[model samples]
Target: MEKPVHHFSELFEQLGLASDPDSIERFIQRNAPLPETMPLAEAPCWNEGQAEFLKEAVDEDADWAEVVDHLDASMHKAQ
Candidate 1:
């Protein structure tokens, strides 16, 4: 079986967030720099469903995990 593939914008959309490039960038800038000690799923910025989805994506190593990790890294990066 082929592994599934996903993208950054798709993950944002899955999180019920704005998925356009500029919106994605703005979202990152606004919520980013997630603390090194914080897990992405535990970020206060996400609602219950969004948080569950993020946690599942990473914990289950689903197809979404790659983009989720990318988002995590993006959020952790310095402006």
Candidate 2:
């Protein structure tokens, strides 16, 4: 079977963060422009559990990987 697709809100919820659209937007705005040299999992904003989850998702290429990449790109966007 194929893996279940996930949305930005779901990814945020998985990270134990606010999952609503407005909250998600605000979060991205607040944390945008993550350093190009810094990995998403290494960003200071995430707590240990959230950081571990992001790292594993990317490392394992799990079902959550796409959305996690989206979040990383969103964070790295030009402000």
lDDT of 1: 0.90
Best by TM-score: 2
For each candidate, give its TM-score against the true structure: 0.95, 0.96
Worst ten in a row by lDDT for model 1: 1-10
lDDT of 2: 0.94
| TM match of model 2 to true structure | 0.96
Error of 2 at 50 (Å): 0.2
* Stretches of candidate 1 exceeding 4 Å from the true structure: none
Give per-residue CA lDDT, model 1, range 1-79, as digits (tens). Answer: 8767888888888999999999999998989898988998998899999999999989998889899999989988877
